[model samples]
Target: MGYLEDQAAVADGLLSLYEATFDPRWLDEIRSLVGEMLTAFWDDGSGAFFDTAKDQEQLVVRPQDVTDNAIPSGTSLAVDVLLRAGMLLGEPSWTERAQRTLERLAPTAAKAPLAFGHLLTALDFHLGPVVELAVIGDPGDSQTDRLLEVVRERFLPNRVLAAGAGPGAIPLLTDRQALGGKATAYLCEHFVCQTPTQDPGELARQLDAFRAKALAS
Candidate 1:
């Protein structure tokens, strides 16, 4: 059976893999999968993804599930994957589509928050502070490891992490270089970045402060 849920779950997992490993291959795979999902399952009139692909066996009615249950609804997972992946991969169209999906479900979600927990999570991410942390240095280096540890250990909501020896191919790492040939971390809010720092303590303090300010406001 060609179910939208299967494809959306795969895309969500791939997004996590990309975040954990920073491998562009995972991102590419997610992009392809999302493209296919949109082409095969999206309802243009409703801006929601159907449970079954349009090309699948015909049914009296094609159902679209928008509520979160034991597992997140396919559409909710799709929105989460698209939003995070778009931010990581520098793709605005994917994020826009995700936004549209949310708008389509807003009234229902607002009426029953408990029934739309997963969708609400995605909405929180969409409305939350977006932090992009880029570490520049050899991945195996101690300094780089320290910076990455700080990044991973921090409780950062709506955060994306990317590390490499140099700028590399990742959009977030573009033009990001280590200072004085030492590992450096660049923390950015929205699109504006703070000064690069090699000290893990400074990075922690900066990130904590940023999160505190966001929570306060």
Candidate 2:
């Protein structure tokens, strides 16, 4: 149990860093590791994963439930890893694997959404467009710090966070060069970005509005 959780922790850490760095290598590494784990842990005929490894002689039943509980399930993590790899790397196989995982869990999700939060999160990622927020500045700077905080607090789904300084305004990317002395926020949903904003309050409101519009549609 500890070993599996540790592997998941490594995957999660890699994912968090990949969001900021946008490095393709991280995506590849995650996919490879996740794929290996899935291959070893999954029950090929049942379309489920055993909570315990196959080598273990002590397990009585193979657990396939995708419950969120206090921690994510092995199957849920596989789905998440596949979904992110596909989205970030534009790999069709990864997307297909994620879809398969979701399809296997659909009945479980329909029975109880809360218990399947992680599964639903993966589903949400696939169903709705993912937004990306890029903020570039010192984490300690007041304005930049506030902007980062507001962005993080927003409950928007399927979003990626990145950091760096950049040129003029662009789509799926922010032009933060204007905030010469402070931090900036670049919000991009479905590959279209709003103009860079320096005011944290304004950014929060814009995010609220955007989320409202998104949920309504």
Candidate 3:
């Protein structure tokens, strides 16, 4: 294995793959990766993740930085994926660990906004009102594509998108089904879901209302 960021990037990429293909295997892979990430990088005493894994060669100090450069810092990316994975898998501990890390870094991040760009992104997700969107349909279906398009049309950073069907699927997709045998989209926040809609237009409207409701709060 490489460093914490490498593993973080892989988990994030698997989440993206799961969203695009709705493949359960990718979800499984992500679960495994997250487990490894926690085992190797998490600092129990500090509640902050280190850039190097536990098994890496001994060094005077374990490097842990939260500033964003060419890519997100390892700490920032770790928090980002943990929050998304927690929502996707219905595992609150993952989210809790991420929250602890953010709590430690929040003061530093607040002081240097430009350097902690991705860390702030992760913080925004943790604060509240992050969107949890789950669409149930075949990846190949054109109607499914239409609904997915509406979701991807705009930039919604605080959102987790999962599209798949059947039992043993990602938690976001489990027990969800198409409305009236048509591809359906479910927009949820804090575990409460609005009416499921299959029409792209209705989906768009519901998204707007949901977003507005979140922003209003």
The numbered model that scores best in lDDT is 3
Over 4 Å off in model 1, which ranges? none
Worst 10 residues of 2 by lDDT: 166-175
Model 1 residue pairs with clashes: none
Residue 4 deviation, candidate 2, in Å?
5.0
Error of 2 at 156 (Å): 3.3
Per model, state how many residue pairs clash. Answer: 0, 0, 0
Model 3, residue 59: displacement in angstroms? 0.8
Tell me the tens digit of each residue's lDDT in model 1 across 1-217.
Answer: 3788899899988877866776667867977898898899887777778999888888898888788999999889889988987887788988988899999888988889999999998998998787888898877789998998988897886787888876545788888789999999999977689989999999999899888887887
Output the lDDT of residue 190, model 1: 76
**Candidate 2 residue lDDT tens string, 101-207:** 78888986998888988878889888876766767665446776678778777676677665544421223334345366667777776556788888888888878
Q: Estimate each model's TM-score.
A: 0.94, 0.66, 0.94
Off by over 4 Å in 2: 1-6, 13-70, 84-93, 112-115, 138-143, 166-182
- Runs of candidate 3 with Cα error greater than 4 angstroms are none
List the candidate numbers ranked by lDDT, top first.
3, 1, 2
Identify the superior model by TM-score, candidate 2 or candidate 3: 3
